[model samples]
Target: MLYFIWQKRGDKPLNKSQKAEDQSISYQDWQQFFQEIESKLLRWRRDLHQYPEVGWTEYRTTYWLGQELVQLGYKLSVGKEALVSKARMGVPEPEVLKQAENRALAEGVPLEWIKRMEGGHTGLVACWETGRPGPHFAFRFDIDALPIDEGKEDGHFPYQEGFRSRYRGQMHACAHDGHAAIGLGLASWIACFNKVLNGSYTLLFQPAEEGSRGAKAMVEKGWLDDVDYFVAGHIGLQPLNIGDVVATTSGFLATSKLNVFFHGKAAHAGVEPEQGKNALLAAATAALHLQAIPRHSQGATRLNVGKLVAGKGRNIIPDQAFMEIETRGETTELNRYMVREAKRIIQAAAHMYDVQLEIVEVGEGLGGESDKEWVDIVQKACRNAIYVQHVLPHLQAGGSEDATYMMRRVQERGGKATYMVFGTPLPAGHHHPCFDFDERVLMVAVETLGRCILQLT
Candidate 1:
């Protein structure tokens, strides 16, 4: 385990007469702290990038993070203890999960930890209680990779630096590796400054964020029920400078992901053309009409059939077809409208072809906005960080995030919540095969968030 308790004997205390620049931790102090921890940040990010995990199959990542936090004197809640077992969404099949578990075990994750995460329960919550009176603060960091193969070309930085993903078709194309690194860095800072801090801190390492699937389970487990302040941040959403940070965000669209299947009678295509129902045609028709869902007059609505698979051979009529579809809208009502329309179109297509249909909802999320009070608090913290060159008051996300679940849960119970953006220039757009960001943003995020926690407490 990495030693994170950075206790120095000659540190000075804050003075009322001192200038803002001469606070307890000044520019020089931040610089020194970053210098001391830069190597560990880079190491963590690179290792995670090379061995990326996806969704509820992040056994190795969960074990590694849990061990680190345990070494730092944190109390941990893993697997079903950290998430509601029945509430998890978009989980893989039992066989896929078992394969992932075996891989983690082969890679040296302990059997005890593996058993705890059996059945796709793979999230963690770490807490530190100071036994003093103050506000409870929480930070969320997503720990899942996308289902994209990493670029192996010489031009890619990870390939050039020998840290490219080792798993086929699994890569950290969304900078979740960087987010996890920043979470560990902030955890170290909290441990180092425990003497000056009071109250409690909770860190949530969420899984399956790519499809907006993880946060609801964590929230349903009551992690945010007692939170006084909650914050979550993402990296490289905008093509901004490494040190630019957005304190708040808006325009997070509500979304739903669905898996639709069609069943039909199979017959020899050439010998009995009239005896079979064409499942492929039904799926194709549904895919076409799903894209044509009328846009809502009240707000922006979107729909897509991302994947479709059907047929066994050219000589036989396909008996089964499957489709992966998604719908999004500016608000919950608008999204619901799109989903209802898509379902109607799908049912009509199945009926027209005389095929049986089954629709399964895989993921969902709600749109949310940050509380202005917490946004101002985070902005002030960003302004104080020496590594931060620009502080943006607000940003338009143009996407969906499950973090909205936690944010809404906290706000509903009279607490404050905000989603932040640690801006960094990306070499490619998110989810692309070559997606990567400037690693310097890692420390900048840690410093800004660490300061925010201190300010809140």
Candidate 2:
């Protein structure tokens, strides 16, 4: 049994050999740990899948995780307490946030837990330290869902198993549910065997990674301020096999996520349509032109206006409109150009429509370029796992992740960082309505991460 009380924080005197002996663990021990925690890990993943919440609105998710950490005697830094305010970009309106909270309440989320994550904050860090001094190590896990309806057909595993998302129109279409499960499982593992570690470790449950939002705030707060190594991985991206893991991967596009609002005077459309500036028309116009922006020849570029809403009635001239827009490029320089052009087009549309315009830069994700040296550490870690049949040295990461922001900060300060792709068999592609991953992959990932923490730190 693991003890509730640990020796203390900070360094304690110990001979080199004693420290080495303390850190040692055999392959048999790894299998034993996996068997002990595997079932509970799968249960956690199912529960999370049933109650998916979108970015910045992951109130229940954070509370669920925070309570578990406390039970394990882990010191938790939560919500506004740990976040840096100025670094928070691309946030939704106060009303939109309030509505999401109300829905969570209606769905029977615990009142006390909801109260803890009241603001638009949902990320947290759980830290643990052994008495022996060593380098600081960190692992990040994203804990947000997507805005898609869950497929309730018989073929969908969630529906068949009765774990479909309770909140209608929102689903864990990505692997975040699996990711969080692995994160919490690993936390439990470390707490149970806390004495084996020489260095301190922190697990970062990040929020709003879907739109490349929410990570900058954590970085700005100096979350990665301490010494040494960092690791974060995603499931079912480039690695499609059940046991194949990608040790080193790059190609995360730089992106700008923007939310724009157009305000104008309302008037009856039939009686005095000219008296009102058409905010709806302006938003729609901006959407069409935004997509038509010229693609740069330097590399790959993408532009999208995912959502646009306006107009209250058929006869009334719409007074307000809101739209979400984003642009991406292979490099930071190219992404900047796209952002500049997008702003110019938005301004021109507002001018032509004679409406007041507001554009909020809610989230950003920069292109990723990982350190080659870090790959060796991850490769060595995966080799220790019996289930990891093949370790692909490199591949393209294929999508945008706010983790790249965290990686950039760590690398800038001379600390090493690498984001990995953990393999899992998928029922459908990510962000799709029917997406699912094999529950067994959860154990494989946690065990590999455990080994990495050992060799790296």
Candidate 3:
């Protein structure tokens, strides 16, 4: 059941070369390719949207992608092989991970896959080696959802489309579901054209991207070490038409995330007020001082104590307190300054209250800029994209992305890397309860990256 789809007027020629080999997949061929799988891509996204999983808890999502990739003849690296275990940051508690794993198993993920992904080791790297002489290209697609409740209003697109999240307090509010689907679509295209391709392709279905957590582990495992080119992209970052694409992005902030705990001695406030050590007061004071850290002179710096919890009851002095904190800077050194200053304030507050303090760094990311060479390549590739109307040179991200770690790793080794942005109309901003993007962007991404691979290989 294939359709002879024709290119619309005003579209750029997909291949301008006179070579016969370049005509192997003509513009009509790509239209047919996309037509055949468009429904499958939508179904995949809806299925993923229905059952969202968060960082370090994406067993089902991993399995869902892995099973299909394996069937596509990719040599797979799952769990420990895909990411360095000790390098994983901001992992959930052991019990929480176990519960997620149990839920995955209950939901029909095979025992074999579960065993490989036990201990919260989720996500996989799928590789296709052509055994021909060429460059190695690595592309990353994050697959973790956020901890947000989906909107159930009649006007909400997901609700109207019957794809609202089924998991309570968990939703794919950041377009990661669409990312995973696009990755799979690209994998299918690559597998179909394996005979015509050269060199190798590695697709990283990365997880735990919500807190800037995931890429470091993959980078530490040396996944991007041999990559001649690395590319990663996000959908709908800006308010742009669905056909717009940004070839390169700038202004990624470096950041560090932490969890701080205070321990003190509890006592009856009426009978033993002097004997009590109030952990609550220690944490509250630290939160205040953490915000008061001197800003760096070199660049913009930010610090926030997002959450704080303490105390047992009204009559008893609190023996424990916990805080979630983060610091960000325009540069890595600037972020380091904020983190260092916040630590000093935390330690001082703990000492002043005579309470034991523990500070655990949960996540970190480095600022990065896209390579111009690769950016040019992406811009050229986007010209062949079926849905792409305009390819912007660059956009200011003004945020943090863990993919910077992989980009740096590749660039430091003398390879080229770039982060791309596929623009799409969004119902709501990212991480919001009603976040939803135009699904047409899925095929746009698949075509854009698929063309890049074709041009590179």
Best by lDDT: 3
Separately for all candidates shown, the number of backbone clashes (residues 3 or more apart, or on different chains) is 0, 2, 0
Please state every model's RMSD to the true fold in angstroms: 5.2, 7.6, 3.7
**Displacement of the residue 21 alpha carbon in candidate 2, Å:** 14
On the 0 to 100 scale, the lDDT of residue 354 in model 3 is: 100
What's the lDDT for all of these models? 0.87, 0.81, 0.87
Give the lDDT of residue 64 in candidate 3.
91
What's the residue-level lDDT of 280 in candidate 3? 100
The digit string of per-residue lDDT tens for model 3 on 55-156 reads 999999999998889898999999999999999999999999999999998999999999999998999999999999999999999999998999998667
* Rank by lDDT (best first): 3, 1, 2
Superposed by TM-score, candidate 2 places the C-alpha of residue 333 at a distance from the truth, in angstroms, of 1.7
Off by over 4 Å in 1: 1-29
* Winner by TM-score between candidate 3 and candidate 2: 3
The residue-level lDDT of candidate 3 at 149 comes to 93
**TM-score for each of the candidates:** 0.94, 0.90, 0.94
Report how far residue 95 has shifted in candidate 1, in Å. Answer: 0.7
lDDT of 1: 0.87
Candidate 1: pairs in clash: none
